[model samples]
Target: MNFKPIPNKFEYLNWQEIECVAKNKRSTVIWPFGAVEQHGPHLPLATDSIFVDEIISEVFKLFSADIPLKKLPTQYIGFSPEHKGFAGTISLSSNLITSMIKEVGSQLSEMGFKRLILINGHGGQISLLNTAARELRSVAPGMAVFPCFLWSGVNGLSELLTKTEIEDGLHASLAETSLMLALKPELVGDDRPNEGNKVEIPKGWSLEGNAPTAWLTDDFSKSGVIGDSRGANESLGKNLKELLINHWSELIMNLMQSDWPNNS
Candidate 1:
């Protein structure tokens, strides 16, 4: 059961069709930003992409079936290269990813889709997305570019997870592993690694590494895992998914109703 919905129309859709659908249906054009990063030994390299697509599909289905929210088509843009050191990790430079997103947002704005939401599945692309949003706003002032980091977007759900030492929740952790098991159980392996070694964090050190300095994903985890993935379960994934959908839906609706800054 492949989860992609846009299918063949990904690269060939014309502005007319996109505009028509968005305007008539009040649909919000969604662009899922994912990375081809390693997910430990159990999960696949495409875990982030797969999980993101599944979550969006589930939310779209819920909207189409029950909620009156307009259904929007989503496209996947894989731009992962930071995990290249690890097996099966493919990444793109920050410049390329940022440029691609800006181009997409600009085109969508031209198509009359003022509301563009970036559904980010990978943490590596967070700053890039922010940069792209700012640039897009500069070009298309009327357009509303909202980049939703799905993990951070889910409010209060992180506190529910048992693991507290997991910083940034990189690679495969309780959150991601649980999401995979829930969304695509067939892909997860049963082997569990013993937990004893933890990522050494210097005294008063933060994700930014040195004082007010930024760090990459590789600087965070050695095995590419932040939190404890040994206790991941399907129940937690489902709960997290529900929470994210509700939260994002509310935010999107609010954005739709609000006024767009002339230089936004």
Candidate 2:
């Protein structure tokens, strides 16, 4: 096969297409950040990437009318420091993630792009991401870089959180499993997860509760799962995607019109 790159729009845009976008549009690039960490036996290690891909696609679809944004291939390996005990977990160092984002943003800035956005799907790397965003703005102040998490601004997850108990409702729990089921059913391996060698956290333990504790996944859950995945279904996942699309569409529309400091 004569490969000429993944010839398409967004992630695979050719230089010529990029030039066109640069000249005619308030150009932005969306990078999907994820992790290659364990997500119980039911979900694949690449689950985060799959979720992010959908997020990137939906953002472009919903917000294209407001601004033209190109999607980049998902950064498949992220900072998963908390998951080090897992066999397949591939975590990057904070310095590396931070430096990589800045370097990429600087290059994009040189390419005449005005904005760079990272739509991260993994919560394990939030600290690194926060640092990356700050460093990008400080080092390349001329380019507007926004680091956003897929789960942070979802209104649809509100009720889900209340019912599912978000404190432990993360990881390979109901919400994440439901999303995986909706997006890629074939890869749902076996939704019936059995607790592995993990030591379960306290019944009422909360990740967000005001507890002065420092622990990782192995210290808490027996399997990689933290919340109940008993009720995960396609409908729940579909609803989340819809709400996320709406939320991101509105967010990008505002970002596109924001009084960006670097906008000329």
Candidate 3:
């Protein structure tokens, strides 16, 4: 049987073609997760979803067609309780998210797939996805599960952004705005808000760090922007896009060439 590399998307293949790839000992599937949540007035509600989807698609394009890698459809709604009060925000329960991961993972294991990579785009669901990945691994022990954040472990961020932007720019901020400009400038709104950076916690505490608080978007940001976007531009967005594509492509290529947990 002539088997395609399973590039672009997994869902596009027929069941027989999918089964062929699944039966390959080194085959891997990536499932991207994103959120339909608030990203301030300057960005679309599907910012997270769009970023993850587009970035992964670009990563897929970098691989040789001979590689046995395929991406599942992007899960567009994620656990986003912090953005509950904002318009256009859709947050799923933690239980529901975990259950979805397990059910899909179990099926993949049954089909003889070797790996499931959850590439998540939203920061709010990071812990939840980690928990879900472990639970999926527990049930589908034969399948390796990797829950990864889209923005984590990427290089050159500090070189492009300030310490303040790195730490405080949590949401629809400079990085996000600039990235959106590079990807889909039509979806970007005209407003570039500079709010929510002043909600001070005690020294040594942060919105998300050691001694983090259970904070909601409404608790600090009125404009639904958590950092300054005044300095964002398409040039920075292009740089960020390049960084993401190059990073993920290298990581995934390494994964495809090795057995990892199953390697002796």
Candidate 4:
């Protein structure tokens, strides 16, 4: 079938155009990963998916036409065992996720693509994706995969949110709710319950850090919220959207402009 090139969309191009673009050693493909999981009572099950899809689309829009970057469709379902306690949460097996990444990366490598950037929105799958990336590199030496979390390396979060929110707001919290309010306010529920903040642990131990615990959503939160969402508003969400878009745009632009992995 004949097809028209739709800017930076990988799937929009016809097979011939795809092959031509893939032949470029500087060509980069972005695959956004997110989860079909619970986000407390106030948010939709596809919260993670929606956020990453919107953020990546905005980031791509900011890039110039000369950038050799194209995006694949978003991987909506992800590894989310931590949220399995809540209804409507679908958790994929770790092996399945790793194998899927390997298979996809292998095909991209075979197509002569040089770089694969997996921008993941779900925090639960970070290490799994990292493992998949490393394994993909081993199996397919022609292409490099960079697994990135949505919130990582983004600046200006401290200016808009409190330290407690940054640390303990793991799910369905102020930042997420606010960002959702900015991106998809109609999907956000009005009941912003402030729960899951009173649990106490040892001094050195933390929920997530160098020392971490594999806790379930039902453990500390009956409502499934892991932080306070009292002051969540649309304004905060707007600021968050800008920060995310700017951070990812700069990062991907830098990647497109360099030949870092192949430089050595």
TM-score, one value per model? 0.79, 0.86, 0.96, 0.96
RMSD for each of the candidates: 4.6, 3.5, 2.5, 1.7
True-vs-predicted CA distance for residue 134, candidate 1, Å: 0.6
Each prediction's total of clashing residue pairs, residues at least 3 apart in sequence or on different chains, is: 4, 1, 0, 0
Superposed model 1: Cα runs more than 4 Å off? 1-17, 22-27, 64-81, 163-168, 194-197, 208-222, 257-264
Give the residue spans of candidate 3 off by over 4 A: 1-7
Report the backbone clash tally of model 3: 0
How much lDDT does candidate 1 score? 0.65
Q: Candidate 4: which pairs clash?
A: none
**Model 4 agreement with the true structure over 1-264: per-residue lDDT tens digits:** 965576788888778878888877688999999999989889999898999999999988877865778899999999999989888999999999999999998998888899999999998899999999999999998788899999998999999999999999999999999999999999999999898887898999988998999888889999989999989999999999999999999998888888867823
Question: Ten consecutive residues with minimal summed lDDT in candidate 2?
Answer: 192-201
Per-residue alpha-carbon lDDT of candidate 1 for residues 126-173, written as tens digits (9 for 90 to 100): 777888899988987766777777777567685667445344455587
In candidate 1, the residue pairs with backbone N, CA or C atoms under 3 Å apart (3 or more residues apart, or in different chains) clash, namely 80-90, 80-91, 81-90, 81-91
Stretches > 4 Å off in candidate 4: 1-5
> Could you give candidate 2's per-residue lDDT for residues 80-134 as a string of tens digits?
8778888898988888898899898888777777788888889877667878898
CA lDDT of each prediction against the hidden true structure: 0.65, 0.75, 0.91, 0.91
Error of 2 at 249 (Å): 1.6
- Choose 2 or 3, whichever is better by lDDT: 3
lDDT of 4 at 262: 81
Task: For model 4, give the 10-residue run with minimal summed lDDT.
Answer: 255-264
The per-residue C-alpha lDDT of model 2 at residue 95 equals 86
